[model samples]
Target: MRHTEREPDYIIKNDNALINLENSVKSLCKHVMLRQENEHLKDLVIDRNKYETILGNSTPVMKVLRLIQKVEKSNIMVLVTGQSGTGKELVAKSIHYNSPRARKPFVTVNMGAIPEDLIESELFGHEKGAFTDARDRRIGKFEEANEGTIFLDEIGEMDLMLQTKLLRVLQEKEVTRIGSNKSIKLDVRVIAATNKNLAQEVKEGKFREDLFYRLQGFLIHLPPLFERGDDVVLLSKSFLTDFCKENRMGNITLSKEAVKFLMDYKWPGNVRELKAVIERAAIMSENLTIQPEDLIFANG
Candidate 1:
């Protein structure tokens, strides 16, 4: 039956070939145009105050800013410890963009998101035919980030076996693929972040002590939003302005009631949750200003 169908319907087959040729020509032209446009696209126009754009004059943010300044000139590994939404990644970006390697790639990997079975392969890559799914060779984050910096978020969530592999990479400055016998030298700097207490995890044997020490070359701790005082109101205003511009709404300011509510609320999700609350208010508010009723939190 399949062989009979393989004998092409002569009339329809010629028409199909002609149509495919025309489609191929059109696709080629479209691809060429896109390539030209991409080539003309200007390089990233990064704002100078990108970090400030996220966090305002809060003491917690100031502390992070100071740490970033102190460590930008060094190649030491940095460990940022904080709650989930406490802006650890922002600190990582600020350090990378302000550092000597700013021009190079800034790669981020969420260790907690990768599967336990593939974490090592995902970080160090695998050679072709290394395992069941290894149909093709892969270049891992460590390789992709060579000569640049790699941000490993939620490092505390990595499995004990992978922690040992990571420790080997840090110590040897090299990586060997899962199936490859040869080790490739690496010059990448690593920045790690986690919400868990590594000291406790070390005593529990969940994390390696040596890896924790290596990752803590320059340790930074970020305070939660509740402890940041007046920055709450300041950040609300900033987020309000940004939301207004993004949604093309007329400029709207926060009311006194709204400001007080923001200041009093205990932000469980930190600055991230704060930004979302303001954006929600900006979208849902019908009045010229964001009133306390317009804020969408349980307390607001």
Candidate 2:
């Protein structure tokens, strides 16, 4: 049978939700194209290696880069753990794109955003007339990502019931659709990410212990932005320079005070927050330079 990909359930459920996911993906890889006019901002920040966009030179970041290289050569499941906004998904994509499966689909399933009821159907396809809304046979994310990679973002948020089924797939390398007796085999690399402490969740009887172990067979923990040393300043420079070019505001450099302003304050929201602040500062500051006063935090 010829394979087909229908519009995903999440896309059909909410347009804004889909847009937000798209934006997050772009934010990691294509930071330059926030607006139609800023298309030239593409590749403005990082090196020509493109998807090697996990920008930083801190010891912590270097360790992450090393770990990514180590696991990319093998088909081991990787669990990326970190605080929110730490770019865990970007790390996962980097591993996938660098691995042998680079040419295959890199399907992403945000287990956190999808409603509990629809998540199962979203992960595992449903047969036509399987349920009231099962109007036609559907191919889920796993099937779509066969011979590639499937990123289960916010995997810790998945309900307990589905976790058992997911564990079985991880062990047996096959998935049985919601209303089918046949088991469809998959050759997909599973990369899961979450901001929550899954070990604590397991201790509290929330997450499946076995599944947690399975996912973390190869773990990559991203250090918080504050712990990443001068990376804050590096990201600040890249963000400011790119935003100025994108907006045609010219080459606005960050002042010494502004550099201190970025480095001294703790970035609780990590790189994502830093990028937002830099972009805002670029617009709020003078055309020539970004001053300390131009920088503003969401809390401030």
Candidate 3:
């Protein structure tokens, strides 16, 4: 007898189920791709804002801006030297965010803030049970910054032993964890900043001479605010506008007397001090116009 041939019902249902699963996966992948695109656009916007924040029209400030534009695309070790509050960290951020590594991680380590005993582990990571507080495996800043940038702020404060280790990492492009013999290769760009005079420190045997040369592959010196001339008024106005908006206050302007006072005063704390003074005046001013009397100087 010839049997009637037909596909079983279960086989047909299985085929439909597979087709639905395939469609679901495609939908999930599309969502993931769209999310990634949105994140990239956000990063672009942030980078543009960072560039704009380094504002000034004075010759000295313009020169620094030009240098930033020139070096943002290259992978080089930058040493930014200036007095305290001169915006050395800002320079470092501008370089990292404007460069090709903009999309990558920007890790910052304040050498002055980290304790000497733990700095090595902080930079190179450590294995589980590596030390007393090591309860789990930890990844260090350098590893986290692979294919990105690492900003070493207050680098002059680092001790000699750690400086030697840092020099080795720069030379070899690799790092060995605290308790492991294996080495992990890295592709991080390093940007260091300091308010101290590293050259003087090197001469005094407080800093390593070899490491100093290595870090100063390119150096950018930030002029103090007093030397920047009329840029003080420009920055003052900008800060005033920002503080006003942030506090939801009406628009404010500096009186002629106030402007003169700002221009004449010596900015011992540099741009940082100027910003603080403006913010205080913005809050303390009785009217939309900020007067000379509203300005307050920090104790010398």
Candidate 4:
């Protein structure tokens, strides 16, 4: 007796069969929105071409640009170690803008600004009834920067308890609200900066070593303004050009002596201090040139 059971032919040669195959293929392709692989975890990379246009071209600044370029495409966590007024935030912004996440939110949370009692709620957020004052659901910085970058300024100042929670988030890529048991997934690129010596803090038992290592995937230590050589002068010029235009002061140029004064003095506040000096001088000097005396410092 002949067997009647049979298997269906997988090959399609008829018009209806061909049309069905094409439609299936098209449907699959539509679902696969392939994104080009990021060579470095860095979604954003710095554009050196705009370096001079934005900041300046001194050796120190160039070195900063190189570091930015090197880490621009990498997704590794960045720890910007620098002194106050050293433009740490600026570097953080540069990294974010240059990376692929440039289009996403670049949120900055000043650890020092937030009250110690409320820092937890501000950072990790809380659900209603989490605490006495938490009357409604709150979204924290990590949640706000879910798919973008979060620049945590003064990370060293974060409380020990909060640091533990932050460490958990870094490890699991998820966050739990104050009162919620559910964990929310995160894709944030954390860029933390501090003026403190984290190594020292770790040794002192203040900062968590594990968390430090996690955030220190890539480190960028900014040199002080005085050590940056002629970057002071370069920054001065850029500041002068912008300030004059900003205040409509009829464009003023820094005299040779003025440049010398700025170079010789110690900028304790770094670039921010230098910019303030330039602005004061530009406003004081009515002539086309800014003289040395136009810069008024107690010691200098």
Instruction: Give the count of colliding residue pairs in each prediction.
Output: 0, 0, 0, 13
Task: Please tell me which predicted candidate would have the highest TM-score against the true structure.
Answer: 3
Q: Candidate 1, 165: how far from true, in Å?
A: 0.6
- List clashing residue pairs in candidate 3: none
Candidate 3 wrongly placed segments (more than 4 Å): 1-34, 37-45
Per-residue accuracy of model 1 over 1-300 as CA lDDT, tens digit each = 876786678657998999999999999999999987764541241245244545668776787778888997789999999887888988888787777777667889999898888888889999999999999999999999998889999999998888888899998999999899999999898899999999999999998888888887899998889999999998888888877888889898888888898898999888889988899898877777888888887443
- Local accuracy of candidate 2 as per-residue lDDT tens digits, 70-100: 9996899999999988989889888887777
Of 2 and 4, which scores higher on TM-score?
A: 2
Worst 10 residues of 3 by lDDT: 1-10
Cα lDDT of candidate 1 equals 0.85
Candidate 4: list runs displaced more than 4 Å. 1-54, 298-300
lDDT of 4 by residue, 113-215 (tens): 9999898888889999999999999999999998788999999998788899889888899988899999999999999999999999999999999998887
What TM-score does candidate 4 reach? 0.81
How does each model score on TM-score?
0.83, 0.83, 0.90, 0.81
- Given candidate 2, what's the lDDT at residue 213? 90
